[model samples]
Target: MSEDNPHSSRGSASKTWLERIASLFNAEPQDISELEHIISEAANRQLIDEDTKGMLHGVLDVSNMRARDIMIPRSQMATLDIEQSISEILPTLLDNNHSRYPVVNEDKDHIEGILLVKDLLQFAFDAEAPAFHIRDLLRPAVIIPESKRVDALLKEFRQKRYHMAIVVDEYGGVSGLVTIEDILEQIVGEIEDEHDDAEDADIKKMATNVYQVSALTPLDDFNERFNTTFNEEEADTIGGIVLHAFGHMPERGESIELDGLMFKVSKANSRRLLQLQVISGKPPTATEQD
Candidate 1:
């Protein structure tokens, strides 16, 4: 019958294969679910890496997430009062180590403008100057609604070249703040700059035996620093080891002995320990104390 068309047979085979693949995929190839599966498959095949996938996922999530979800909570925000003196403002900025801070008057809810820490350097250099008012150095604050999507916020930030925004609730009260860096961090992960505090430093020797140690300090680093043999491959941080030893979350100021060293929880919350004050030497056992 007209020399059995080879092209028609090949076309039929391609259609069948595509239909079978679509059946296995369980969704239309052009749909969002299919796209996610494609990305996962690409990751599995090593065609695209995990980091790339993570960033892609982050970028996608930004469009879906709102300002309230990612904005730093008000409790954690380090704000500057425009009425404060240079001495007070300088120390506060130095302590927090932030580039920009929300300038407020009366209270945190009455935010006036953004303060660039570098602007204070001029006044710091010339303490004898007569007309260096804090209000003069303030940049116009960009206030955004809590419900604003991060994607839209990022676009506005880019268009206006604004780095920070004050997030406000429906009542127009200062809820919190969000930064351009925070939005980018979502897409690319945490951005640790030179000014950022070292999150991975070992036990900082504040004194001879007493030290300020992060709960996240590695067990190996802790052991090597203290010259102890408290080894455990199952745990990474000393906190994890402590948790394993205690079998529960220890409250703040709780002291416990492990591997001959005593650890006192210096900074902790309802959830977990932040920092511990460690002292070398055996603590008194319950039996010995009794």
Candidate 2:
């Protein structure tokens, strides 16, 4: 008999392992839950990473969500008045730091068109440019229904090559706006740029005596930064302390006073607080006193 080839045996073993792995993914998942189970199984087996697994689930979640679910409410939108001169418009643009603005009449519901910041750059650089007219540079705004599915909206965004859309209610009233980035954020989590506060920072000074604070900031850290004696034993984080003081879950814009500090819920979801606008009420610190 011919001597058995050792290489052939090793090759056969490798092929067998691959087939077993292939079988794991061969079956069609029966439903969303089944598909999630398959993805979880793959993660457990080290076939895919934890981050990839989360994104896969995010994609699945996005399919069930609507435009209204992630839209920036009308009250919070940064818009420009169509009748404003460049001098008046520039301040609002600079403060909001947005690339696009909805050009509206006196009422936000009366949206004129979208203004792209790049269109104004010609006036800034060219001395011989014609007088700036907001209407001359307006781009047609894309409108979508508030009930539009997020996944479908994302597909349309990709196909149309547009970044932003105005969302409207059933009665044709502008409810809010949603962007491609907002939908993508659901998949990849928050996409922070240089202007955004560093992820590790707990508190950021917004303006005179006003600060934007992460709800997750430790009570000890808050005390050290602001010269307060809030008891850490009662709650570990500023969020926990606020929750305890509220006696119930507080919605966005709700305000509370604790230990000379004014805490206003700046960002929150139905489940928990995400951020707070804190106004310092404590007596002047030693440096300020001096």
Candidate 3:
């Protein structure tokens, strides 16, 4: 009776440790900020790893974000023209290297359906495959409002087994596009693959006269690349110059002529521009006849 039971002593110590751990999360978080604080505290105490804590925060961030916040703006969308022949559309498919493309009738606003790249594999590989029509191969496109919640859209994506959705404004006009991958990126971070550009050069040639320029590219670098004298004193980066010229934040698809060159906003978010598609010369315009 005098000798303490070893098992009982060990059990008592385990109970004390468990109680201490429980006390850390005992208080219910009154708000998201409070919950975030608790998550951070858990990470501090080694209850959860830093990565887990970050993912939890990302989940919270996604809950508050909407389709408009992350959707790829219409101008940057790689689409297939429904009227184009298979041979004509092949080049676009190859250049863009996207798994899916929105089949549009005449413009981005007139989406017909979705085309899966896999569906074209038979035509490419099988010599005996029957002639196919683009209309016959298209799958129905899912359309969602720009204000749709990212979390809710993600849930729908899972339930419906679809990966992409066309985002529309309140006026029922095509706004942009959102994908399940985009939503997942918010949770697990950027999901880069083999196709993703490993070296994201600030300025890179995309076509004969079109180039993709990073918004953060130094003005000096752009001047050197394009052989133009843009005053660096006004702005350090090309994006800054464009922003100054706009007098406000510009949305994707907006274009401005600078130093005789056309700079089209290709990729952007609410806060700032991310990428620009620069044309070496001013875009062609129709002449007004008297």
Against the unseen true structure, what C-alpha lDDT does each candidate score? 0.73, 0.80, 0.80
Instruction: Please estimate how well model 2 matches the true structure, expressed as its whole-model Cα lDDT.
Output: 0.80
Q: What is the lDDT of residue 132 in candidate 2?
A: 70
> Where does model 1 exceed 4 Å of error?
1-31, 200-290
- Name the Cα RMSD for model 2: 6.8
- RMSD per model, one decimal: 9.6, 6.8, 8.2
- Give the range where candidate 2 is weakest over 10 consecutive residues by summed lDDT: 281-290
Report the Cα lDDT for residue 34, model 3: 61
Residue 136 accuracy (lDDT) in model 3:
93
Model 1 earns a TM-score of: 0.62
**Candidate 3 residue 137 C-alpha distance from true site, Å:** 0.3
How many Å off is the CA of 68 in candidate 1? 0.5
Residue 197, candidate 1: alpha-carbon lDDT: 56
C-alpha positional error of residue 85 in candidate 3 after TM-score superposition, expressed in Å:
1.2
Q: What lDDT tens digits, residue by residue, belong to model 1 across residues 1-290? A: 52498888888877765664456347534455555665666678686799987776666557667888667656457888888877778767765667999989988899989999888777667869676668989999999998999899999999999899999999999888999987887777656667555532445544445566778788876666666677658688888887777778776457888777788775443335556778776432232211
lDDT string for model 3 (1-290, tens) is 42478888888877876665465457443477766776787789798898888787777677778898778767567898998889999888766668999999989999999999999988989999998889999999999998999989999999999999999999988988999987886676556566656333466556566777878889987786677788999999999999999888997678999888899887565546767889886332232111
